[model samples]
Target chain A: MTKELFIQGNQACSMGAIEAGCRFFAGYPITPSTEIAEDLAISLPKVGGSFIQMEDELSAIGAIIGASWSGLKSMTATSGPGFSLMQENIGFAHMSETPIVIVNVQRGSPSTGQPTMTGQGDMMQARWGSHGDYEPIAISPSSVQEFFDFTVKGFNLSEKYRVPVILLADEIVGHMRERVLIPDKTEIFKRVAPYENSSDFLPFKADENGTSPMPAFGDGYKVHITGLTHGELGYPSSSPDDHSNLVRRLTNKTLKNRKDIVSVDLKYCDDADIVLISYGSPVRSIIETVKLAREEGIKIGYLKINTIWPFPEEEIAKLNCDDIFVVELNLGQIVYEVERVVKSNANVHLIGEIGGRLPKPTDILDKIKDLV
Target chain B: MKKEIRIGGFGGQGVILSGVIIGKAAALFDRKNSIQSQSYGPEARGGASKSEVIISDEEINYPKIQNPDVLVAISHEALLKYHTDLKRNGILIVDPDLAHMSEISEFIEKNEIKVYQAKVTKIATEEIGLRIVANIVMIGVITKITNIISVDSAKKAIIDTVPKGTEEKNIKAFDAGYNLDFN
Candidate 1:
């Protein structure tokens, strides 16, 4: 019998991480995201895992990276300000190709914005916050169940690609309690280990799949891990050619396989003249907005993005619609990406909200009525 | 059938827990779809707090309460602040001693609202000997009057939600409210 739970989105995320074999957690308590750390702190030790209350977000990400190298799935949870503090290490994780999950339960932002409210302003920061030429994997959950499902998916993707996966949650979904089915079984992906002999192992060397087999620190393999642009031996390299190869591999590992990495939910889009695209809490409102629009005899639909990073460009490009509405809790973050993908084929519109409030269905429907 | 409920009180009034228990009862045990969301001020206590729950037979798309079918306010300030958002002819549950019927009589009558009075806090504190269980008492009252949540499912939720070893008292508090004759 499948076990069903009525849990907060943050609790579901923590449960999913535990199911995905996350044994190490290091994070500072931050509103909107603190519950994730709070739940894991109690759950991890019971499962013979480790949970550390890091002094700050920087050390939190750093500790997770270290734990990942020490052969354990690790993660950290934080909100906007904390997410910002972890950016440099996020780039470090990218450069070093360490697998970890960072859940940013986003609140209103820039600096110390609305701590108790919801915001998706970090959508752009998730992609470009680290300041580098590497592709990132970020998944946004629309509901409590999706929060659990995508957290496991985040861990799996992080393991498969040896990169930090971002689970971009928001305060609305993080705090809300809803039904989530605890799957009878889960498919966990373990990172491939390198050859047993130390001499044959090159930590930074990319296989045909654009990821090198990872060897744990105590696995009898000599490994040199660094944040510097490194060569195949994982040693810092000044040579431009080595840097180019390493960076390209880091980016291509996920970007090249976007088809397998990205996911979206397209509803009523086949005959839709207008499609509403959104992620996180705003997606819920847009779903209702679609229903209201249909009642008014509008050929409107919605595309809920599961994978935000890698941008799901191919899916947006394939949308054969005349108009597209990108709804978000921020003043137009993901809308630019939708416009970039759709180009001149469709008239792209943005239905953005700030002040940490989810857009109401009637508000979105009014926007549609004004246009159509 | 989708029913939206909003519970409001001071921060320490267990307002949020009531919403959670209701949502849990509906979604987990009662085999209904439910969503619970909350908002509070920066202060940890003594601030206006709110918790909203939506229980539906169909999928719940909008998580927030636009106009609640049932509004349970445990504090007078909360009742006055949120009572206007209650749907026309909606059910309004409150503690008469705490919420003061006079403050809302004009508006309630204007909206054709059904008002149910119970001394939830007094029953919880005097009868159950635990003021913290007032929310549970309110939950019981809500279940009895609104018929929005099942009594058995709510009992299960209360047991699972309250602190360990306090389940019995919480259940008693719930029963006190449940068996009340509000007619």
Candidate 2:
């Protein structure tokens, strides 16, 4: 039987990770995201998984990568400053195509602006923060329940794509308490293992979808990894062709399957004159604002992106609405992405906040009223 | 229907815990939807802190309490800070000894809000023998006055939320507040 536990968002994320067969956790305690580490620290051991508190965020991601290679699903959780520390490693994980979950319970940023306050400033950071052209799979959940469900999805996506999946949650959603019904058992997604013989196994060989099946460290396969561009055999290669081929394949894997990787919860958008594009905590206020706007006889629709990156440009491109408002907790991060997609077609407005506050329903409604 | 609730007190008074218990009672036990959020920062250390909850039969979208229907204030600062935001005909639950008695009396006469009084801190300290259980006591009192959550369900939630070995005393503290003659 499924038991309903009234837990905070961070707890739900931890539970989801465990249920998704995360056997190892390595994290440095960071505010707003510390509860995830705390919960996993206690729960992982009881579930026969190993938990380690790394010295810093660099080691946190590094340990998870090492653990992933060793055949155990692993993850780490952090906030802005910690996330900044993990970016170089985030790129490394992407380059290695390691299946690991990184939960960034986002707090005020730039440099620990406000430890306990909320911010969506990390949206762009989640994608390009690692300093490369690699496409990252990141999801920003709107509610506590999705915090649980999405972490499961995050792990599955990581394993499926052979990529590092980031669950981009903000402090408000991470700290809020709500009812979460977790089932006793859930279907788990494990990485595909090698189908080739040990003698013929190639670590970096791409499948049709560009994902190379990962074998466990001791699973009768010799694997070598390097930060430099490598070919199918996993040896370092500095040749332009090898480097181009490696990076292109890495980016293509995500871009080719972008539709499957991107999902949005669309509400009343078919006939909406104005559609609001939102995610995470701001979606709550947007929902309420739509209800109020309806009472005023205004038609408002919304497209909430639970999957933040591999940005759902296609969804915005398909919308026929006159105006699309990109609402986020950060100033003009997602709006730019929306603008790039809806250029010369729809007016893309930014209803954004930096930190210390979230977008209120009335605030959005007032913006709609001005447009109407 | 949706009911907005604010449980306010000093940082150490377990104000946030009380809100979580109430939210869990309604969401987990009553099978309704409840959302709980809190105030953080420096005020949480010594001045004033609060936890806000919204319980609804339908799914909750906007989690903030714009004008709370039920207000539970356990500190002097909380009472003054939140009364202006309390809706008329709303239920205001306060610890009379903790707040300015004269201001509360004047506000009661000037406004048409229903007011319930209990020495929540005193009862928890005196009857329950633990000052921390005062928030649980406040939970009991609020549940009784508003009937937003059943005593049994709220008690179960309290037991589930508090640390082990302290459940019994917390339940007793709840009873102390529930049993108070606030009429």
Best by TM-score: 1
Supply the TM-score for candidate 1.
Answer: 0.99
Q: Compute the interface RMSD for each candidate structure.
A: 0.6, 1.4
Tell me the spans in candidate 2 whose CA falls farther than 4 Å from its real position.
B42-47, B103-108
Q: Which tens-of-lDDT digit does each residue in A244-268 have in candidate 1?
A: 8889889999899898899999999
Q: For model 2, how does the per-residue alpha-carbon lDDT over A203-283 read when each residue is reduced to its tens digit? A: 998999999899988898999877778988999988899989999999998899987789998888888888988999989
TM-score (0 to 1) for chain B of model 2: 0.95
Q: How close is every model to the real structure, measured as TM-score? A: 0.99, 0.96
Which candidate should be chosen as best, given DockQ against the real structure?
Answer: 1
Q: Put down candidate 1 lDDT per residue, B1-183, tens digits, no spaces.
A: 999999999999999999999999999889999999999887889999999999999999999999999999899999999999999999999888888989778998999999999999899989998888899999999999988889999999999888999989989999999999987
Question: What pairs collide in candidate 1?
Answer: none
